[model samples]
Target: MRFSVHSVSLWLCAIPFLSLVGAQQYVLHHLFDHTNFFDEFSFFSEPDPTRGVQRYVSAFEANAVDLAGFANDAVFLGVDYTTPGPWRRSVRVTSNTAYDSGLFIADIAHMPTSSCGVWPAFWMFGPQWPYDGEIDIIEGVNTQDKNKVTLHTGPGCSITNEGTVASTTLKETNCNAGDAYLGCTQATASNDNYGDGFNDIGGGVYAIQWTDEHISVWFFPRGRIPDNVESDSPDPSAWGPALARFNGGEECHLPDHFKKQSLVFNIALCGEWAGRVWGDNAECSALAPTCDEWVADNPDAFAEAYWLINSVRIFQAHEA
Candidate 1:
């Protein structure tokens, strides 16, 4: 069904366990949507009729993008904040897919994304959770103090309760109390790199590097992050001490699951994760008085809490 609109292409490399040598060979599921530049579309309460995607997304910029603090030299994703959303205003895909890779990097300058029912996830997953897999590169609950970066895999899948990774001191001996995955561990700066620590630090760059031996992640502030990471699998030494170091060391049996998948960037409003933060609407306290305000304002302004993106570039580990 050609809607007479052009489609964009975004890519992510997927594989079960990838080495740096095989990372660059991956490509995107769809073609790059060049016409869908940051300025071309309008923010909407619904999906764009011309965008070509099956669902409607409040494209970035329509929300609220205040680039004052980050008057940086580079023009990332074209905006600074993110598009407000009940669902994802994804430039990549709406539904969601999973992937495995030697390396995956999400360079985001997230706003203080602490809103009730607002789950801003920059993560990845496999087809059927647990059995397939899920990697939460960046995820948190109601508050921003404690952040959680975990890997969920089993006969099916499971998730860890929220905790802070800013300290990068997470020392878990295993995954979900030994449900399915062999084991997992987290190592990061305790106060300034993991969880809200990363987001609070102006939301710079978060990279997850995976291999058959283990899965690890690192966070670098805007200027601190290097350029090579985007195109290559970085050595763990660069970012803290490998945020999460899962045991089993390749024996845990995480099969090949990473495949070419679409990138999903969403600012989900008041859903599962966000709802949990505020119980029965009572948790909407002063810290986030705008909780409901943003919700109410979403379709109205159709572009309030809009998170501007500068640019999203996906690089694959070149297979040997």
Candidate 2:
């Protein structure tokens, strides 16, 4: 279902009247493509916040090692697959722009495949950690077959997936970032929405609509993308049921929790989440004695651990 990057327009003209609510027009605000991805995103060379056994490199280092660049006219972010060491080299980037509310659309041609010790995510978070809220749009650990959309807030915030697809299961209701930070989570049912299955189908588009009232996420697999989306005018109301929807009524005011968020993409190895649950997964555990040990030794096994992003577009809603 995935079309070549050439077929999709890199520049999306602002659509003045794509409505999500009465008189609210969604207009194109930002576009991230191969031509400007490297410039717009800052390479994070800091120590892994998740304590993953992966070294995030600078833009210069990433480019020198072929860990981050452009491929097939798409933005490529990859990991070190040939070097055997305690920590594998990888790339993590965060957008320079931060947004409070908008519709985000990511057209991806490929993503890191499911593998033991590998954790890949495309998420957004505010500057002040849980206090400002975090949104996990596409995330999973280890060999997970499905994607999990989660929200993390400081306290006094809980959400319900009232309008999500039937196959999506709400795992937690409490979004309070307690000591463990087990945020509210929704598990998707489709295998094709994540990991190896996702890559096999030529990847897809992941859309997120965030507003004061609620936040919703949708996945349009390859050829199944709505005509409106391809045409630069997205109407979530006409996109049918979302894959995951977090309702923020009086119970949980979204604006109070989620604030200006920066988009992030990264791949980590043997991280807290993936490493902690390594023993529970029979397939992953059999590969080595421990997650870190396995990730350190098996360099070739992660050949497919990379992201091929066609483009990312942001649309902001304005009163018509």
Q: Please report the candidate that would top lDDT against the real structure.
A: 2
Residue-wise lDDT of candidate 2 within 160-180, one digit each (tens)? 788899999999888884532
Query: Model 1 over residues 49-75: C-alpha lDDT tens digits?
Result: 222211223443222332111123222
RMSD (Å) per prediction? 9.3, 3.8
Task: Give the 10-residue window scoring lowest on summed lDDT in candidate 2.
Answer: 1-10
TM-score for all models, in order of appearance: 0.57, 0.93
Clashing pairs in 2: 1-223
On TM-score, the leading prediction is 2
- Which segments of candidate 2 are over 4 A away from where they belong? 1-22
Model 1 misplaced stretches (Cα beyond 4 Å) = 1-98, 156-166, 169-202, 227-240, 256-262, 280-306, 311-315, 318-320
Cα-based lDDT at residue 319, candidate 1: 49
In each prediction, how many residue pairs overlap at the backbone (N, C-alpha, C within less than 3 A)?
Answer: 66, 1
lDDT of all predictions, in order shown? 0.43, 0.87
